[model samples]
Target: MVRRAKLVNDAVELVPVLQLFSTETYRRVYETLLSEWRTLEELKQLYGEGVEEALRILKNAGMLEIKWRMPSDPAGKPEKEYHVSYTHLSINVYISLKELNTILNAIFMAEDEESEIVDRILEQIGRGRISVQHISRETGLDNLFIRALAKKSLKLNLKGQLVEPAKNEEV
Candidate 1:
């Protein structure tokens, strides 16, 4: 039980982990882990016998992995513990004019219009992608300004360039 609680707590500590699973599953697993450690049977019953199925799905989707530990008992080892390993997904996002406008509106609601500040924050937090913060810092613009500029930039955007053009080729 303590082990299960620990595992759930670890997942909860990482917001992305919670986001990886469906809300209901996250809530139920959280609640269950918070309580006494449940046997596989108990877990199955709690999840309408779909616990295994759910794990299978999560595993297959590369979203989660489970590790089983042997129970400490005189009898032959039982599946003692189950731990969930969550995978972080990386997705490249290309924003259309409309989407860029939406994001700009959402981030610019602050009275200070810390658009530039926000962009800097995003850039600093980039995960193989440029964030608003990066754009803001690079261009010395506010979040709103950066956002607008980014929209314009995207309009003229070429697909991500994998290899830089050689000196002789057009830039």
Candidate 2:
């Protein structure tokens, strides 16, 4: 088999691909196909019942393909052989910035106990402008993080070096 690469993005296909080596049977079946094409019965004889499952998973993930193999002699039964399609695999793990924000928002929603942390930070800010260091000392959040959360997240209205969260609470 030539070296072919498969790109797996969906979770359904990715699980089996990632487990190809660790799952034992999947690795065996894949290696078997890599060496040469084999019929279902040939695979069954070597790996037993698990061969079917491994083939199904590998086939669905674009790692294997089926081809018919005919007997050399007359009146002999033909067989369906499984061949490997790809010898290499590639995975995509990048998530869009919008998706990342959605996930972060879910974990930090101001509800019940989680709201206390938000309230604590909000309380540190007075109606008048205050320094990021003051908020960090009171809330235990880092100074740089405080500035980012203020301007980027809480939409704090900044006046030069200082910010007033009282104005952000309105938004």
For every candidate structure, what is the RMSD over all alpha carbons to the true structure, in angstroms?
A: 15.7, 18.8
Off by over 4 Å in 1: 1-27, 30-39, 87-89, 93-171
lDDT per residue (tens digit) for residues 1-171 in model 2: 588888755322344454456468878988989989899889989888778767765654557788889999879987889888888877665655664454344334444644464456667664332777777777676554454344332324334446565331210
TM-score of each: 0.31, 0.51
Best by TM-score: 2
Give the Cα error of residue 148 in candidate 2, in Å: 34
Worst-scoring 10-residue span by lDDT in model 1: 162-171
- Give residue 94's error in model 1 in angstroms: 4.8
Please give, for residues 47-132, the per-residue lDDT of candidate 1 as tens digits. 66545544433332334434455656768666633344432333445546765454445333453444444444344444333554
Report the alpha-carbon TM-score of model 1 versus the true structure.
Answer: 0.31
